[model samples]
Target: MNEISSILAICGACISFYIGAGFATMQEVVQYEASYGSRFLIVILVAAAIYLYTNISFATNGNRLKLNRGGDIYGVYCGVFGEKIGKCAAMFFDYFSAFFCFMSFVVMCGGANSTLTQQWGAPFGVGAVTLTVLVVVTVVFGLQGIVNALSKIGPIIIAMILLVSVVTSVTGWGNFTGNLTKIDQGTYADVMQQVGGGNPLASGASYGGFVILWFAAFLSELGAKNKLKDVNIGMLLSAIFIFFAAGVCCVALIGHIDATAAADIPALVLAEQISPVVAVAFAIIICAGIYTSATPLLWTAVRKLADEGTVKYKAITVLAGAVGCGIACFVPYKELINVLYGLNGYLGFVLVFAMVAYDLRTKMSLKHGVENETAGIDR
Candidate 1:
């Protein structure tokens, strides 16, 4: 691809991957961000900053390291501690990340089922099966196919979210400040249960943590394939778009905090307040977001198990889809998101620290090398 197209593709893929079922549905936003009242901006800003740093680091370093597999990123980061520790840490991250990815796929399926049932009164199986089939088929085409599909679908889904959120915010402008006042007054204590035990900073950290886990393998792989400059630009754009979209959605949710706090899909609830037509359209957008997110998550997990396009890989993909669909159909969507995201997010924090250490070590080593070269030249 040309430079512009390449940049857009990377930007789209990263944003789409981040804007998964929880994000599109606004459940994550309500719980993790908006629940903090006026401090929501601070929480999201913290998240966006982490996203900017980790994404650039992963993509650019992946290009430089040229690792054989994306998951090997853990080894590189953990190797900072020592050889034995690196091996253990790498293996733990591989298994844990794979498990997290699969569970995340299940969350997507649950989101699809919930959206369809709530919006259209469709049978639960229809949404789960539909999403499963789409994800499985796309994954079978491999990473290039996944990226191509997401690069197009991602921007469309993001636009729809922004449109819905902005409209909701404008129409409910009068209620926005009033709601923030109530939150600040502690009137909605029962309504706004904090994600990180009432600490916005911890909540923000966890939010960044889970996201790092989600992108670690996926971005690394993308970086290994694309130019560093393109990856850097694309990831920067992704961070900006994600933070802005999330901020708008957070404001929208805050405007309708009373109703949104009680609902499973806050964004859909807001859209419905606008009109049934908007609600239906946003429902479809939610499913699309889920698809884009699910495809990469499932691919990341399965890619760890088998090489792309192999018979074994195809078999595993199909099996994983089937299993995920079955579990999602039975589980409560909101509860699943809370348990999985909350726990995995904290684990992601550990990975973030490792990444920082790795970055510092690499920069120091480069500096040392430059000094050695200067000494030789002087001699």
Candidate 2:
């Protein structure tokens, strides 16, 4: 019973970490899935398969290798080439991932501002500053602090997202097929141009790729601390839940394609269509989702620079929060999501290839070792 609870906790944490501001807002779904029209289901399924594979690989490898730092997983993945090349690759990934994580933090702040302004007419600064302070304070408490908070908050937020998305999709089913046909006929061509342009396959791959980058270091660290069986099961569950929720959300968004395509926060817009009270409730839930994601991303970036609990770590945390808030206040949230996530997702494909290579090499070597051991025993 305790073991089952632990696995569920891990699953919830994984889902929560991946949810983030863009996802909870439906901005990510708009760009990656819903914009593709009738083919959105296929795109999400493709991404979900990739998510499961990458999560399992990172977690299991992290447990087996037990590296000193989470970032070291890159070194292991690249070491299949040569020691010198591996070190270079590791250094590159470490720095690039740190920058990426920080930029993602900036996106979270922007999302917070957008959500608040759209829902309650709050000042942009109010949301940005409020989210930044909360994130920085939580990050200061470090990894365990983050895990504890996310484990509890993650499940609740995911439940709320599921409920809202499922209800919206069901209620709006009358509009769904017609909206899909309109989308296929290019009714919203201009909106599609703004959100995305890639084919379903490329978009799906890119979606999975960027998400792999997000989980690489974090899951590796998690695997190092937990049992392999538990980590594997947890990640598998997370992958299933994420894609299922995304698919449902995509259906809901498609049913209201006109409003969703134009709105900054489509999920909130859909909820508002249901009731102002539900919209208000979902706004708070979205804020919580943003908080859950921002905490780990900030921690990942800062941890790369300084050890937790050190004075340097705390100082960098505050400074990052400030800079991120400043950036979020100026940049449009949609622009940030469209540009950063799309570009970085392609870059993440490179890491995905590296991870595949590492996995293959490891399996072959293990097979060879087993063969040699059997021969010796027979002799």
Candidate 3:
């Protein structure tokens, strides 16, 4: 692929990967739109810009490290953090991925069940089984194959969302303009109240926590364990995609019923409103996203346990899948989201600190900063 295609592919992977079950519904926007309010877009823009910068920065260093897997980079950061603390952080982050992945798996089932139940009175058990099978097919193909397919499907997801939202609004005979005007009038404040946080000030600690969590969600750095093509474009494209996604979600929020539901899963809710076909499209999109979240989780866990043998490799993958599937069975959809978000927030705090320390060390050798050069292979 040429530079443009390469970058877009990277971009597709980075941005589309994050558009998981949570993002499509309303979790992402609620964090920004509800907690942050009209100011939410500002946070979305800023977060996208910062994430874009970090992605590029990470790629620049990761390629130099040529570390083969992301855990190596984590090791470097861990060393700088003091072996004890660093190892602890890595363990926390790595395992968290597994927990998050399983939770998402269950959610995909719930989402599919939700759609099926709403249509043709189909039993949820059948829908859940179907969704699980579909996910396994994609996983069996491994990350590269999925990425290849997503390079096409990712943008299509975005386009379809935009098309649905725009078409819906237009067909509304321009009530879109007036209907959206209600958004700024304080509907967000009410929604947060329903979600366990009364108001931003009252829930200051809680909402502040979410801002931090969003930062931690960016763990893979575009899955650039070693070298990826179109390094710079890949990341920038992700930023733009995120910004666009945030906008589409908000439009759905302002246009839909549960103006308060804006905080939930706006995409799926919006899809349900647009048409049954739209809902199915969103379901497929959610499944695709769950795959994205599932990866870093499985990769992190498997890396810790497996060595260079096929015996260990297959073992790790199965373990990861089993653990994740088990969690899906037990965890409630929204509770899982809250836990993931909170965990991301705390981890983000540490990562940002690492980012700062790394920057300082890079600028001053006296600080003993590692330039992300491959230090040594991990055992």
Q: Quote model 2's TM-score.
A: 0.95
Each prediction's number of clashing residue pairs: 0, 0, 8
Ranking by lDDT: 1, 2, 3
Question: In the order shown, what is each candidate's alpha-carbon RMSD?
Answer: 4.3, 4.4, 4.7
Which is better, 1 or 3, measured by TM-score? 1
TM-score of 1: 0.95
Cα lDDT tens digits for candidate 3, 122-219: 76455455555555555555446546655665676666657666654454434444544444565544444222232333223333333322223233
Q: Which prediction has the highest lDDT against the true structure?
A: 1
Model 1 clash pairs are none
lDDT of 2 by residue, 1-379 (tens): 3778778878888888999998899989988999888888778877887888888988888888775567777777776566677677877887888889999999999999999999999987789899999999999998778887888888788788888988889888999999999888878877653333648878888888877767888899889888888878988888888888899899999988888887889999889888999999999999999998998999989989998899999999999999999999999998898888888887877888788887887788787873121110101
Give the TM-scores of the predictions, in the order they appear.
Answer: 0.95, 0.95, 0.76
Minimum summed lDDT over a 10-residue window in model 3 is located at 210-219
lDDT at position 193, candidate 1: 52
Give the candidate number with the greatest TM-score. 1
Q: How well is each residue in 252-276 modelled by candidate 1, as lDDT tens digits?
A: 8888887887788888999998899
